[model samples]
Target chain A: MSVDARIARGGVLVLWAIFFGVLWETGASARYLGSRTQWIVPFGTVVLALAALVYAYGYLRARRGGPALTLREASGLFALLVPLAAVLLVPHAALGSFAASRKGNGLHFLSAGQSAPSKPSDASFLDIRMAEGDTAFAAQAGIKPGLRVHLLGFVSGSSDVPRGTVEIARFYIACCVADAQPVGVPVDAGRTFAKDTWLDVTGSLERRGRRFVVKGERIVAAKEPSQPYLSFRT
Target chain B: MERAGVAAPTVPSFLRLRRAWETGVVSETVFGRLLGGFVLLVVVASALRLGHGPAAQTFLLVFTSIVIEALPFILVGALASAAIAVFLPERALDSLARLPLALQIPGAALSGVAFPVCECGSVPVARRLIARGVHPGAGIAFMLSSPVLNPIVLASTWVAYGGHARGAEMVAGRASLGLVAACAAGLAIGRRTRASDLLRARPGERAEAHDHEQGDRATAFSTHLVSDFLFMGKFIVLGAGLSALVQASVPESALSTLGGAPVMSSLALMLVAFVLSLCSEADAFIAASFTSFSSGAQLAFLVFGPIADLKLSVLYGATFRRWFLLRLLAVTVPLIVIGTLIFEAVT
Candidate 1:
């Protein structure tokens, strides 16, 4: 209703534009948005920045006109600060083992590798199929029980499996963290690792009841992948 | 009607100020008091080291992610809405309203195919449409349809279910059922209500269209755009916070106890969709991940989510009256359920 109020609200929009720009430039969007970082972050930044400039131009056109912003309006504008505060105050981390506890560690998540090589030589390929429980594909790939497989994933302390085993899990994010689902396999590594520890696990694949279990023969520390979350696009 | 030469009765200063405050014209002192109280609460909360935990971390991530994900769409909607308000000819709007109701509702529902915005963007546009004298039912139909019938959403649905045995069926069912639900809900909501009764009044907002001068079109557009974005953006932020809390705290299994039964599974997934408040374009992948649920249940999720969700509920609250959500669900739920069941029976 007032030029000052418009400028104040526009300043908030500018702050958001800055936030999004920082998110895109610093690559922080990947931790929260995953694959969506490529488009959403830049687009949001541009839209917000242009909107802010438009708002500022109007305020400049009528610099001294109208009443001040009302308390309710001011409060509503201030409420936008919540997300900014949350983003700043909360420590940022990738969704990991703790998140899996709620989202579950299941292989039901769809994977990009719907069709793979028969008798695949790559251990990761076998590992993914085993995780997906694609017995037909596994059979085609000659991946039977006791076949040696090397898989890369972070350890998750999933209670779905037996006490002696921890789940080795990877998240497949379709959009953002809200839609992320974990695909994991129960593995017996002899020694326990911290939750979310990246590990290169070379193990013999075994079937126990409905789920696959990995008998780890060689376990080594592995760095988290540059693109930690998996997506069909990549 | 005052008597000639009679002086109007003057009120006491304190009484006038009290009346002003009660009528929503808050004084600087009242505003400062509120600001001070909020600052004190924040300081106390910070001193307590609140929001420090795995759950809080998860909540923060989800909350901010949802905000970041949804804001761009809301901004787009605001810009589109402002354009409609400032640029679209009044005669064009009148022509839209002049159409027969039967044709208008269906036509508006199908128009979503041309407008690719999702639910977040649709809300502001719908509000502007109603304000600009479009048939309220048609505006409502347009709002409900754009998110689901849009090409991007259908393409995503097709791709998400591409690996499934009934991918085509899912896409077809989603499109058809979504259109049906949108029209039904629109007809029901706009049946007896006026636009003023349906939409919330924005405080300090300029009068809708009468004040616009020919030269001030750009200024008016900027005003509407900024106002709509800020208003809608705050609610989305608050809504995202609520959704994040539910997503972080509630175990998925807690709601899935009835995931086995056909009717109950549909209801359960609908509840999940509400709680998750995911974007329509992205929700199909999440629905596809529910391999344990039936196809009908997944369909329920895909259909129910874009129409109503935690985020949309908050936005709706800010936009419409209390009865809006109830009226919406009363019309939409049964249609979606019956549709899904038929989908299940057919396939």
Candidate 2:
């Protein structure tokens, strides 16, 4: 390729590096890769930037009167640039109830080694997946017939559970959205709420047969959290 | 040539190289056609108003996720490929190639442990090895095995399944199956194939084709790094798009019924591995979550995924001829199937 062409191509590469690096720095990468893999953005962006710089230097000495890249090669480079549009033009987003519904069977987000959330009253961290932490915290106060706790999650599930209940759900992810699975708890608040509505519910846990049902003392609307997926180490 | 900090392509030779490139290269309007198709797609999507919710949301989610996840690994691979071009001596590569095919293939496969890269990162390195006169089969072996045998991947596999009943056994199975399949494929290809038959001449490669043969390490390295990044990066975009489409549309749970039988579950998980295209480092966690599948089937997912995935197939297209990839799949798929079944019988 000509010097001008090479320089132009190198410039494009630098722009891509900047776009992704900015995405990572601004935390947009978390939407695509799980929060744990954010480290890749920083490390990867730097490598790309360095390669671009080297490419840019070559363009200076390259004479202006040179043959252009074959059409095939130019197109290949252009296709590489397509992701830039995907990043900048297409909207930035995080996976949510829409994704959950597509997953068929709801995801089980708990880590293989993670014990079911311990009781919150024990002053230990509860699993954030599926509102396990809140339920565990409430259970510690009592995993009895009438144990009350505060809970927050996006509403999920269908008619099977019971009336006056919502499935408080969250995706638990170890790596990326591709591996994300839905995990949720059955909450019986005695009032119906729209599906996928983010809610803060003050509820009590009751043990009925093998199921631990949360009956709500209060329920109100809430906003989706900044980071939607509850992350686990892969 | 007097080298000073790896000078860029000079004027006259660049022209000469461009002319050489035109000579057997088929001319076509591929990129322009692709652009037309894309514009048409946007128009159709807009007309249908399909950009509104879940379906569009899911498509973008999966598409961008694959792009984001795989891009960095490709960068790492390009850098390693550059290093090989700049620093790895041709003599060293030649000596390794001099060994018996059996020894060379397995040795290359075993050496993957120290490489620490996933499948995306390994492809360019393998291509570079082939360009440097290493046997095509050995290069292919390294490409296939490094992602599976790399220490981090192995550790992740162990950790993902460590809590299960046959955790250690699963890890061992993945490692052994990976090695056998890779080496076996390598030898099969090496026994009679020629470079012209296996490798394709990608556009923009001609510039480095000169510096590569000469010992002009600096320029050669930089040229290759740029060439590889651009070539591999485009295919990555294509592969990621294909993978995302599968992820957005397909409900994996639908296949849960296929989980009941031994060979069926193996084939089923193999299909999952192809589409999901999870990084080898993280696939184990997903495989482990398949509590319903037999341990052997889970092993099949872990073994087959790193070698052949929707993403890797696109990359193989970029780096090799079409038939080579088809042959590769033919050999690899059956080996994983039989290997996993044997583990099922024994364990």
Candidate 3:
């Protein structure tokens, strides 16, 4: 490739570096990578920057004449550039009701008959999900029928949810959002809420048939948490 | 002097710059303009459309997350590849080549126990190894097994299943099957083909092939690094988009329909594993979530997923010959089925 084309490719690399740098600077990488942001974002930025520098130095020393840039080369660069640009330009987002419907809730683990960690009343959604599955965890946390708990989540309209109730859901992300599993319990709020509306529900856990439902006492409007998804670690 | 007067012709600076771009001297300006226009267009379009629904919202979230998570590993793979290209001595290559195929393939497959990188980070390193004169079978084995056998992945698998009564069996089944698939595919696919036959040449690579070899070590290292990064990175991004689309549009119930039949369940979960394109380290938790499926089927999900997924398929396409995935599936699918079956029968 020509020196100029090579340099152009380098510019594309710099664009990616800038994206990572921005993610790191704004602490937005945690939203994507969860606990991994501490290392991956900064290290990725450095590798990309160094790679770009290598191209820049090559351009400075290069002679003007070489093969013209090929269509394949241009397409490769754009293929990398366009989607990331689209992501960068779009307003930040999180997994919501649509994702909850498609992915299903994390209740399947309840049937696995496994042990789980004990958590406090203010535990994350993942902890709550796991607690519901493990009898030992529930006992240790003093969780039982008619015990009131505070739950923070968005309203979901998944079809599996019973009528007259909305699934108050948060995603349990393992690694990243791609592996996010919606974990929720049905909240019988006596009224319908718009899907993906963030809500804080103070409710009592009640067993109905084989499943658990939360009987809502106080439901208040809430904002999405700064870290919207609940991760495996705190 | 008056009679001989002639006007001097001059070109405007913009026209001069355009001409320079046309001839490739200032071609970088064109790229800069293309990037700027594309970004502006996307920003405007997203502002209008991103708020319309959750599907687009989910797509953006999953797409960016996958890319962000995978990039660091891709960079690490590129760095390792560059090191192999620039610093791995001729003696090491020769020694690896001299090993017997019977020993080389299994040895390479087992070496994954030490490598902590997942699937995203193994492809380029394998490509570099093949290019640097390692046996094709060995290189393929290393690439295929590294993600599955890596300590982090194994530890995650153990953690995901450890609380259950059959946790040991699941872990053993996954590790055993993963090793079998890797070694089997390596021997089968890499049997008669040389590197020239198996590896796809990157665009512009053929023209400057010798130039890369002959350039200063630093130049060569960086060139290889950038080339591998960009080449593999774009395909990964595209694959992530497709995987995200599948994730958003396809309901989990669609696959759950086939969850009861033992054989069909394994196949369905394998298909799910392919579409999901999850990182190996985290895939076990997802796999363990399918409590209704047989343990064997879940093992297939674990083994087949890390070896081949939508994202890795795209990466493989860029790195290997067109038929490599086909060959890979032919060898691995049967092995996985047989392995899972045996695991079920025994356990």
**Per-residue lDDT of A126-212 in model 3, one digit per residue for the tens?**
555566557676777666677777889998776665666788888876678887888877888999899889999998877765446
User: In order, how many clashes per candidate?
Assistant: 1, 7, 0
CAPRI-style quality class for the chain A–B interface of candidate 2: acceptable
lDDT of 1: 0.80
Cα distance off (Å), candidate 1, residue B35: 8.4
* Residue B114's lDDT in candidate 1: 89
Q: After superposition, how far is residue A33 of candidate 3 from its true place, in Å?
A: 2.4
Work out the TM-score per prediction.
0.88, 0.85, 0.90
Scored against the native two-chain complex, candidate 2 gets a DockQ of 0.34
The list of candidate 3 runs beyond 4 A from truth reads: A1-3, A36-38, A54-68, A108-120, A131-133, A161-163, B1-33, B50-52, B163-165, B206-212
Estimate, for each residue in B1-347, the C-alpha lDDT of model 3 and write its tens digit. 57776778888999876655444432456655766887788778777775347888887788888888887788889889988988889898899899999999999999988888889989999998999898899999999999999988887777777545576677788888999899999999996889999998766565345445665566666667877788889989988988988988898768666666777888888999999999998888788888778889999999999889999998888899999999999999988988888999999
Which pairs in model 2 have colliding backbones? Answer: A107-A181, A107-A182, A120-A136, A120-A137, A147-A204, A147-A205, A148-A204
Better of 1 and 3 by DockQ: 1
TM-score of 1: 0.88
On DockQ, the stronger of 2 and 3 is: 3
DockQ of each: 0.45, 0.34, 0.38
Query: lDDT rank, highest first?
Result: 1, 3, 2
Candidate 1 residue runs with Cα over 4 Å from true position: A1-3, A63-67, A106-108, A111-132, A139-152, A198-210, A217-228, B1-50, B163-165, B207-211
Provide the TM-score of chain B versus the true chain B for each model in turn.
0.87, 0.84, 0.89
On residues B1-347, what C-alpha lDDT tens digit does candidate 2 reach at each position?
Answer: 97669777567977877676554232235435655776676667656655456666677777777777777788789988888877887789889979988788999999999898789999998988887788888998999899999988888787777546566787789999999999988988756877667888876666666665665555566677877877788888888889878877777777555666788899899888898888898898888877788888889999999988998899998788888778887898888889998998899
